[model samples]
Target: MPNRRIFNSFFLGGFECSSHRRPDGRRLDLLSATGHDRMTDADYRQLSAHGMAAVRDGLRWHLIESAPGHYDWSSFLPMLRSAEALGTQVVWDLCHYGWPDHLDIWSKDFPDHFGRFAAAVARLVRDETGPQAFYCPVNEISYWAWAGAEVGRINPCAVGRAGELKRQLVRSAIAAIEAIRAEDPTARFITAEPLINVVSGSPEPQHIFDAEQYRLSQFEAVDLLTGRIEPGLGGRSDYLDVVGINFYPDNQWYLGGSTIPLGHHAYRPLSEMLEEVQARYGRPILIAETGAEGSARPAWLHYIGAEVRDARARGISVEGICLYPVLDYPGWENERLCQVGLLGEAEGWEKRSVCVRTASELRRQQALFEDVAAPEPATAAE
Candidate 1:
């Protein structure tokens, strides 16, 4: 059997560390709101106890680089140290939907400043931790483009300029990847984006084309990063590394109507989606983020897990799955308890309680996969 690379664990805990500007121009820091920022030690302990050996987390760009070219590692150092002590591997998000206020995202300087900051981060992490690192350069280029540029729902607040913003983000991400690689030769990158299916509401050719185009648009960011499309943004084939697919219950929907009922005639099986991604890029893939709120969380994981197993059975290098927002946090638009995490917040900032139902299901699913050993790759097609 060929040597296979896997993350430290098949299960990962993803902190909801979104630091983004809301529609009202207010900067929201979810790490602070959930108290995870101040409770790194306790959080790491809980993660290890729950058999989560890897995590997806992020740095608050605005806080660290309060001024141009200045980064305050004081805020992030503790978390890094804690994760290292706990033997947890981390995939950090360099730009989690927010950046320094002094920088103009539209200006050419955005990528320049971001690249410099990324290089500096790589150096500090390499020196302090002395291990290979993984990074998602920008959290979700696709969703950010639509929400921030097209709808005027977030920062940069540009209406009808999503394509332009996406190019800018791709430029920044490419620059960051190059800078980080220059600092640490072995750095790996994961591009996190929503994977979806779109269907036309009618049988008209135009409607069909619209849906097909909408579906294709989801891959634009990754395509740009890979030089498969939009090579002008300094994208190249080397820049595209691992791919992280973020899926939710509502991801599959009619182009102009309600959510597509799963298992319906039009609903695409996630196995097919994973296959399309593999056939397109042939890179390692991870279900970077998947979760649900309330009682549906465990069932959602079970369903996705089974699909992932099926994908792997087809010889896809589908990697481990991640439960994003492993700890419940407030909703972005409202302070309402999202209840989407495997763990629930406790009264004390440093403590959390596992959602018993989700935890049980996770163990059951883990056992289910373990029972079926991974089949050896076929050396010759029969």
Candidate 2:
């Protein structure tokens, strides 16, 4: 029954470049050829103006070390300085996806390579910024493994080896955590992972089994991080301080021939997910990422607010809810980046005309949910 504080801010990790690509097929332009143009100071100032107290930003290992023992800090220093100046705490994501193009994902040296890289970043950030910075060794381990290794969605897209990918990801996370902690023992750790709750229309044995396996696969990383898995597989809970859940409305799915509307997916309320994670891991939970894709943001905000309220009433330590990609970008998944931004893209940014209608809607939704009070707990005497 740990007490939790509501963390208010828009999630901005993916927005910053860390040698990763957006859903729109755009790679982050954080660093230039000279590695001189990393995340600018103005970015932090703008985010702080939006009333942001925290930011999820990146510290890429590959960018720091294009080759072994070749460390570079010119690109990342500004990011750390900007966060400090803006008074914004950061959840530093070490590895968002794969390493630099030069390194292979499945190479045997990958884990140790990443470990050294992480240690270097942690030491640099700690020496320069002190020990208060938060760190997430890797972002969405399960999702990356499934999408990259099993589903063939991204680079090195291998298939049918979900277990192998999961194992490697878990080991990588553990190694990264160890490396960071070695430099800064008091650094806070939050492991962000997608929480997929799947539901099928068919009650047939095969369908039910598939649904269960899918859900189980989603939690594989969590189980390993939280020490719930059997030993000998690198499943140790020593570094799992916070369980970060990146949930989306599309997480729940109806199987079979059911014709549920695209927006009517049968997802579990965020509260339910919060409670389950707390019960299982006994750690504070943060909705590391969550948001809807559309102009009807008021309804989306209200729905998510209701879910958070429900969870707070149950004495769950629901720490925060971050709206993913506070701003829209172009070229998302298959060039179909849905309008999932609080603010629409600027006019010249993409070929599609900017949606002016989203401006008022975004303002209204932000106001509605800005100061939402968590539901009060029930009295035992009642």
Candidate 3:
């Protein structure tokens, strides 16, 4: 077995459990849609077979809290129990771009109320599964802001209010952290944000500055959490625990232009990006979400694993890399089958089906990791 720190395994599987509504106002339950919710035990067992001892999943806020001050754990408890039974450590995501229908996001007490709910969740988990649980409150604040506020892509479907949405998400997350600590002090939090690089396409100096600034905007969420940039949101150093970053092939681009894929001339190396993140926050990092769709899976994984290996060689404390949405599911926009996950949809609730090539590649990487992670032999005795 590999000797691993921070998590039981160096690799983690993430499920796409987005409960957000589309711009057309139709609610999406990706977990249920993919049958993971109904097949928790099998899902976890399948992940464990792939050597993923840790997983990143979500608890649908809207489904959990149907009414104010009340919670229905019908959809969550079973999944938690399944993970425990399968010996899979989980980093739970609370509020993944969706919330209770009765509550207004812009309301004055949103943060406080969210904090209270988060506290209750912490207590529930502690009472059920014991301590040292991981949580990501209000997942991807910066991305959510851009999606929901800037482009009206998702719920709360507002436009021209990116700053406002960001501030609110940070406030809610901060408040939730405090509330959760009140319930369980040993609980760890993950501030998951995108790590991207942008370059200027224009020769104008102002354009260059704008592009760079936009790149820096990716750190605003963690900056607020650590009180580095936006202290007004009540962020403190302690609030920034394990820094989680999401990266994909399309992460880099030229400002006002096309995406610069990995290995392109203008594309930035992921190792350099990881180094910058370490320099900025001075905390351990987890590649919370990363994967490519269809035939790009194997190559993307190889690239990411190499980058992470290089990052660690440079003494960066990169804890793990997660194959996000490790199970193939319907797309949020058009419900198309995204063949990204290592596992495909199962025919039944107890048996799990997998993508063969994906599974092979995953195991190949696992064996390689084990070789590196194994301890050295004993020295010659006198």
Clashes of each: 0, 5, 0
Q: Candidate 3 regions off by >4 Å?
A: 1-4, 371-382
Candidate 1 Cα lDDT to native: 0.86
- Kindly report which residue stretches of model 2 are placed more than 4 angstroms away from their true locations once superposed: 1-3, 6-39, 255-266, 332-338, 344-382
Q: What does candidate 2's lDDT look like per residue over 70-168, in tens digits?
A: 888765787788777766677877887747666676877777777888888888889888874577888888887777777767545678876777777
RMSD of candidate 3 to true structure, Å:
4.6
User: Using Cα atoms with residue i matched to residue i, what is each candidate's TM-score against the true structure?
Assistant: 0.95, 0.82, 0.95
Q: Between 1 and 2, whose lDDT is larger?
A: 1
Error of 3 at 161 (Å): 0.3
**179 Cα displacement, candidate 1 (Å):** 0.5
Per-residue accuracy of model 1 over 94-113 as CA lDDT, tens digit each? 89899988989999888888
The window of 10 residues in a row where model 2 has the poorest summed lDDT is 373-382
lDDT of 2 at 114: 79
Q: How many backbone clashes can be found in candidate 2?
A: 5
